[model samples]
Every structure is written in structure tokens, then in C-alpha cells.
Target: MKKFVALWLAATCSLALFSQGKPTTKPMYLSYGPTDGKNIIKFNLLGAAIRNYAFYGERMLSRKVSLILGCNFMPRGGVPYLENFTDDETLKTLEVGTFSFTPELRFYLASGYGGGFYIGPYYRFERFSLYQLSTTFDADEEEHTIDLDGSLKTHSGGIVLGCQWLVGSRKNIVLDWSILGIHGGISSGNFNGLTQETISPQDQEEIKEDIEDALDIPIIKSEVTVNDHSAHVKIKGPWAFIRGSFSIGYRF
Candidate 1:
């Protein structure tokens, strides 16, 4: 009877071991992928050949999801016509600078392969300083000089979406494409110095009187008084961009 009891116990233990599955272990960090222990970096060169010509620089942080910081420089030049006057034109030039910060979320399409996409929103703070020169050529020659030593400040927020295709997984040779939609509020302070010199005093008085009568405003008979103005400029809307580039980096 004792021998039979020992044999039954041994059979039960063998059945339990066979029915239970083998123990599972977690994957080691290094076995995951090349990016398991490192960061990524990128740079860009951009140019606009439109109303406003501009240049941009961008830096991206290293991580599963990264942060991007960038800056833009614009040198603007244009010839504008005055609606109040017929056949009158004004030529002007200005320089503007903008800085931006954004957080991005990366989606890995396939694990162990070095390719993914990202999307995010950004806040941009912009500063504008104008160094403008204007000239008007009419039957009677008139010259105006303007200097804007004061700086303009504004805020803009936007959304950006893009994708990246990496080549040679270990080397970090990535090609990226993206689109940006931006909008914001703007305000400007004028430190503008404007001076008007007519060909003759008679022409000066004639022009001054016409301006006053047309506008029905008080006339300052003096030759000139410094004019400074300040106002809020609205720059809210949707703007988009498409970019593609190749960058070399590393992932530890």
C-alpha cells in the first residue's frame, strides 16, 4: 500500500510539470533596437522666393518623442501704391526675425526598423525691426525719410506634421518631409522719423492745405513735428510648408 501511494504522488507531479508552460523572460534593453539607448539630431536649410524672402534653422532633440527649436530670418522689399493718391508709389524694405519652440510625438511604424513619423504644435515669438527708406517722384519732387529704431513684438502658435524615412539603420541617414500651419497676434510701436521737403515753399503750403481740407483735421502750420504711432497688427491665418532633407546622425 505504501509503494502504491509513492507511485501515485510521482505521477501527479509529472502531470503538473507537463501541463504548465515554460517560464517567460523579458527582452534585454540592447536586444530591442539600435535606438534603445541613444538620441537623434537633424538640421535644415530653407529659402523662400516670394513676397518675403526668408531663411530657417532647426534643431531636434533625441528621444522616442523629441522637441524642436528653430529660428527664421527675413529680408523684405516691396513697392506699394497709395489708394488715396493717383499714380503714386512707395518703395520700402524691412528685416524681421522669428524664434520658435515645439514638442513632437513620434510613431514607430515598425519595430527594429529605423523609420517613423511625427506631429506636434508649436509656439512662436517674433520680433520685427524696420529699417525703411521711401521715395516719391511726382511732377513736383517730394522726398520723405523714415527710420524705425523701435522693435515690434508678436506671438504666434501653429501645428506641424511630418514623417521620416531612415537609411542604414545604424548610421542615422534620415530623409524627412513636413507641413506647418501657423497663426498669431501682432503689435508694433513706431519710432518712425518722417520728413517732407517740397521743391518750393509755395508748393509746401498748397500741399499742406489740401491735406488738411481733404482730411478735415487740425493743421500744424510748423514745418514739421515728429510723428510717432502705435497700433495692433492682426496676423492670424493658416500657412503651410513642405520640406524634404537628408541628415546624418547617430543612435546609441
Candidate 2:
């Protein structure tokens, strides 16, 4: 895609410029996204298509170790529910916006300042807030509604294995890939406003059993959140990904 090409070129060029300015044994570089990954405090126009904007900075702590700090944001958009609600009232319900912070420590196995194969541990925290909704749903083909409000928080940590490439004369065009990565975390929801009809244990079991058929949205089966009073829920699960990145930036 044109976006990817631009991202790689921009990241590479930006990092190259940074690298040229300073002469130090310790390598310092800046890069950004699968989209626009700017070194300085800048916004990504391309990543905005997916409602994502990412910013990052990196410096080598030692000859073989580097630290990267990154933040990604969705300014005006929110994550969607697992399933689409059919009714007008349900459709009108609004969720909250989200942002994430990632801190990573990389141990380079290959020898280079700009490009190398590296592996490391990364920790990411994602927060979603300002969510409050009142919507109706069908239970046992009977219609009912509940009001709820809550914020969701996720804490995750994992390992990533990847390599970075340099393209420019000074190797500033950056292309990086984390061929494999896995993260596990607990997702918690906190809420207080729950108004609904009394539900029996059997009813809860039934709802859990055929959750897909009962509700308009689908959450992970393994990570189910439920309650008798107003239906408060929290889910714990694992997160995994194949991460690839491209950035054009200066290296110093």
C-alpha cells in the first residue's frame, strides 16, 4: 500500500537525519508507526485512517540494549462492541475513547546502530474511559434493558522478537518487524449504575451458555463477565500479535 511505503520512507529519513547530527558510541534514534512514525512530537496523518496516531523515541542504554517508549492514541473514536446492536436505542449507546502506552527493552543480538535483530520484553497499558450506556436486549426472547457505567483497563506484558532494516545512505529509512509476540493481561471493568430485573442462577447459566444467540454482541467465550445485579462484568485473557513497523526518522 502507498501508506506503508510512505511510512517506511519517512521513518528511515527521519532517523537518518537524527543519526547524522550526533557522534556517540551510544546510538540514539527516533521513529514511528506502521503509518506515520515521526521522531519529534508530530502527528501521523496516515495512521489517522484507522483512528490511530503513534509517537515514539528510542536510545541505546548500552552497546547491546536499547529502550523504546511509545504512545498511541485514538482522539475522537472509540472501540466498538463485539456485536452490533439492532435496536435504535442500543445503536445510540456510545462507548469511550482509548489510548495505550508501551515501554520496551530490546537486547540486540546483531551488531549495528540502526539495524539489527533484537528481542525484548515489552509492557503496555491501555485505558478506556467515559463510557456509560443504557440499552435494551432480548433475554429468552423477552425484551429487557439495563443502565450501566464503567471504565476498562488492561495491563499487559510480553516478549517480542524482531529485526530492523536501514535503507538510506546513512541507513535512516527504517523498517522493523516483530515476527512474533505474545502478551497476557487482566482486563477489568469498574461500574456502579446497574438497574435490571432480578436474575436467577439458572438464568445466568443459560445466558452464558448461549450468549451468542442471546445477545447482539459477542465477547470472548473464555473471558466472560457477568453478574446478577445490573450485569457487571470483567474479563481476563491473553493478547498476542505479530507486530511490524516502519518509520523514517533521524538517528543520532
Candidate 3:
């Protein structure tokens, strides 16, 4: 009887010690700390006076790295005449598209406050098309058809620098701004459609004679050879963004 009682007491004491040591953690309630890195994705809708619809995609590469791609539709206006031409004709309306890719490095000055700066190199592609319309002569009463066989396209490459700030505790909202320098070439095919028309054969003969005389000048053929075709056009300017965005993020 004594042996059985001792065995029972030992079992009960072991059970009490195990039960009182620590409570098992419930799956329902859990807690975490800040400073944990998160994966961030944000989409932005953008617009400007020159551009209509613009969209952007940003993904976090790391805690301090990101990749961005953006595109925008620009409606080109104003008919600025080229300096080589004597005519005052200007380029009319046309659709322009711009695409950019940038890999950025972000520096966080403060952890919780969400203040940072970003700078990176970028590649930009821009395309523009010119359409020819009817031309009106200064003295002629009737208009003539202008044949524009195709359009001009330009490709540019440059670098971008920018900064950003976050508002609120959750870091759900952010403000961003940027500027870029773009440089490339503008390529336009030959302009062979410009021709003079006269009602009288005598006027045609006179114009032909003038052209022949102009060609007889002693200027070097290579120097006088006018080729408006360019493989690249230099585009350098400032690109800025003032935007507010919300982001959904995940932490591992």
C-alpha cells in the first residue's frame, strides 16, 4: 500500500510541474515587430498637359532597390518649321509614345518615418509621326495635296534622379518626384515630295532654268549635299513627377 501511494504521489507531482511550467501558445493570437522588410507593388495613373494617359509599374528589388517601367501617350502639337526649309509649314497633330525603364537605388534615412531618396540610370524610347495635309500657296487660289509617305521616329537614352516621401504610420501613401535627361537621334526619311506647279509652260521652263543655274555653283558636292535623314536625335530635358500612391505589401 505504501509503495502504491508513493508511486501515485510521484505521478501527480510530475503532472503538476509540467502543467504549471508554461502555457501552450494558441494559434489565434500572434505578434510581430516593425523593421521587417516587405515586398511592395504600386500602380500609378499619371497625366500632364502634353501627355494624356500614363501608367507606371514599380516593384521592390530589395530593401533598397527597385525597378520601374512606365509608358505615356503624348499628343504632339505646334508646327515648328525646320530651319533648312524656306516654307513656313509646321508639323501638325500626331500621336507620340514614350516608354521608360529605370532601376533605382533607394536610401532610407529614417526607418519608421519613410523618408528616402532615389537615383538611377534610365532608358527612354520616344516615337513621333508626322502627317502631311493640304498646302496653300501664297499666290495660288487653290490648295494642293501634300504627300507625307511616312513619319519620323526618335530614340533616346538617359538617366533619372528622384526622391520620395511617405505619409502616415502605415506607409500606405507616398509622394514621389523625378527628373530625367534624354538624348538620342531623330530619323526622318528623304523629303522628295516638294514640287512647284505652274499653270503655264513658260513658268515651268523658267523655274527649271533657275534650278539648273543654282546647281552649277562651285560649292563642293559633298558639302552641299543636303541629307535631312538622321539616325538619332538628341533629346535632353527635365522630367518631373508629383504623385501620390497607395501600396499593398507583404513581409516574409
Candidate 4:
């Protein structure tokens, strides 16, 4: 009886070991998480075409949520596409540079864990610098040229809607398109102009009037002060902007 019991116990131990080493035939369902691509870096192709260097970075917080940051810089040069919109002669000699930063939170509306349509709220802080700008205004029946320089800064918040797609064999390539974005906020700036020749009292007043007249828009207000050789402009305005971009990127 003792020998039989010993053999049975050994058999039971061997069977348990074999069962523990067996592989399951159950199907696998992969879920997107930290193990998959969870971060993306992108470049704005549309902005680059217009001389604006723009870049964006995104990180997934969950299956349907992400956080993003975008930055853009345009080198000092003539205003882009200004001639296409207006024939204003005064703007022909103006040059400007721009920089902006935006932060956003995106919520995706799709079935899968990857690319899809998304709507996000974003906040933007932007700045513009005007340099070496020259404009002529007639004072005392004489054409006088004033060299002007200034900077404008604004802060705004808005919502953007867009879609993204993951491409390539491993879905590591990302294409992002921002369909539409709208923002509105306040802007303030100051510009100063200097003339080579001395300004008469009458000419100073006339210069102030001319500056004010040019800025007489329903949505914005400005104040002008003129002295013997220089003129100053203070600007306060409500500003609005529309945002759009097409970008390509890689996921990691």
C-alpha cells in the first residue's frame, strides 16, 4: 500500500507541472496604452510654406484624451500676403516679425484608440514687432516721411476642430489638419515716428490729426501725441483671428 501511494503522489506532481507549463489558445485583443505610441511631434507644413516656422508636440493622457503645445516664429520681413488683400500704399514699406505660443487639450471622438476627429480648446499668446517702417504724410503742403517702429501683443482663447490620421505600417506617421479655429481678445501697442526736419506747432497738430483719422475704426481706438521732431501713437483694440494648419508628424 505504501509503494502504491508513493507512485500515485509522484504522478499527481508531474501532471500539475505539465498543466502549469501549457500555453493558452485564447485570442488576444490589443489595447492602446503606454505600451503603444503615446507621444507625437509634428511640423506645420502650411505655415512653413508662408515662412512661418511652426511645430507641435502631443502626448496621450488616455484613450480619448491628449495634451498639445504649439509654437510658431516668423522671421523679420515684409508682411506676408499683405498685397494680396489690400492695395494700401502705406503698408508697402512696412516690415514685421511674429511669434506665438499655443496650448490645447484635445478630446477625440472615434471608435479606436488612434487617429480621429477631435475638438480642443486652446489659448494663444502672440506678439508682433514692426521694424524700419516708413510712411509719408502730407503736412504744411510738404511731403514728410516718418520712420516708425513698434510692437503689438495679444492674448486670446478659442476652440479648434480638426482630424488626425495615423499612417504607415506601424501607424507611426501622423497627419493632422486643423479645420477651423476662431479667437478674439484685446490688443495694445505703441508706435513712435521720427522726422528728420523740425516740426512746427501747426504741423505737429496736423500730424496728430492725421494719425487719429487713419486709426478711426469702429472697433479700435488710438491716441496720438506729436512734438517738435517726433510723434507717438498709443493703440488699444479688440482683435480677432482665425487659425488653420496642416501638419505631418511621427509618433513615439
Q: Specify the highest-lDDT model's number.
A: 4
Task: Note the Cα lDDT for every prediction shown.
Answer: 0.42, 0.60, 0.41, 0.85
lDDT of 3 at 58: 55
Q: Cα miss at 192, model 2 (Å)?
A: 4.9
lDDT of 3 by residue, 130-159 (tens): 444222222166643333333434444555
Ranking by TM-score: 4, 2, 1, 3
Which regions in candidate 4 have their CA more than 4 angstroms from the true location?
1-36, 112-114, 137-142
* Candidate 4 residue lDDT tens string, 166-244: 8876677889999999998889998998887878787777777877888899989888898888888889998899999
Name the best candidate (by TM-score): 4
Rank by lDDT (best first): 4, 2, 1, 3
Cα RMSD, each candidate: 10.1, 15.1, 12.2, 6.3
For residue 250, model 2's alpha carbon misses the true position, in angstroms, by 2.6
Pairing residues by index, what is the TM-score of model 2? Answer: 0.56
All candidates' TM-scores?
0.48, 0.56, 0.46, 0.82
Decoy 1 TM-score against native? 0.48
- On residues 1-252, what C-alpha lDDT tens digit does candidate 2 reach at each position? 999999999999999999998686643333333332223222334445556677767766666787888787776443444245454445355566768888988888887554689898999898766455554546666866665566667888988887866556544455665567677776665543454566557665554454324333344323334467555544334444334344444444
Output the lDDT of residue 222, model 4.
Answer: 85
Tally clashing residue pairs in candidate 2.
Answer: 22
| Each model's backbone clash number | 2, 22, 7, 0
